[model samples]
Target: MRHQTYGKLAVLAFALVLVSFVILGFTRAIVGFRTARLLAAPTTLLAASLVCLLFVRGLLAWSGLRPLE
Candidate 1:
């Protein structure tokens, strides 16, 4: 159950990253670099969050705290 939740969260995180890029591209085209840079903050934070989640999941699996089965 926990692993499944993690998997779903990971996918959601990836989707968010993709959406962020689309937003960034649109803003860069319509507004400017400054606005795009400001918008990038959330994307960067989401990327970091995703990395942390993956790292914790890996550690749990490695330590046998959360087995694949």
Candidate 2:
């Protein structure tokens, strides 16, 4: 099946996952960013990325199911 079959929200969710990874890389590359609060950016991005991935995957899976009602 084509990805479009999953719906637009799924597409947006996947894009968010990609963008999060890109931002995560940039945050990790910054110099002198060891302060506690500044250090949390990458960790937060990772968590957000995981959630987006799970949401997209769940949408795809749900789209493939058929209800008997």
Candidate 3:
């Protein structure tokens, strides 16, 4: 049950991140902010956060750390 819950939460979090990235990309494109300097920070932060979350979740699973009931 705990593993199932964590898996669901991880999927939800990933979906949210993907949605956010699409929104950010569309906004930047519409606003004509094509330059890397203008759009790098937020994109980088979002990507980093996603990566960190995945890493943490993977580590937890690998180390046999179950989610809270």
Model 2 per-residue lDDT tens digits across residues 1-69: 344544564555566656655655666677444543365565556657756765667666678663212
- Candidate 2: which stretches are off by over 4 Å? 1-34, 65-69
Models sorted by TM-score, best on top: 1, 3, 2
Better of 1 and 2 by TM-score: 1
TM match of model 1 to true structure: 0.76
lDDT of each: 0.81, 0.57, 0.64
Candidate 3: tens digits of C-alpha lDDT, residues 1-69: 466766776676677666656766776866765553355556556656766776787777678794444
Q: After superposition, how far is residue 9 of candidate 3 from its true place, in Å?
A: 1.6
Q: Which sections of candidate 3 miss by over 4 Å?
A: 34-54, 57-61, 64-69
Write the residue-wise lDDT of candidate 1 on 4-29 in tens digits: 87788888888888878888888899
Candidate 1 Cα RMSD (Å) = 2.1
Question: Over the full model, what C-alpha lDDT does candidate 1 score relative to the true structure?
Answer: 0.81
Give lDDT: candidate 2, residue 60: 65
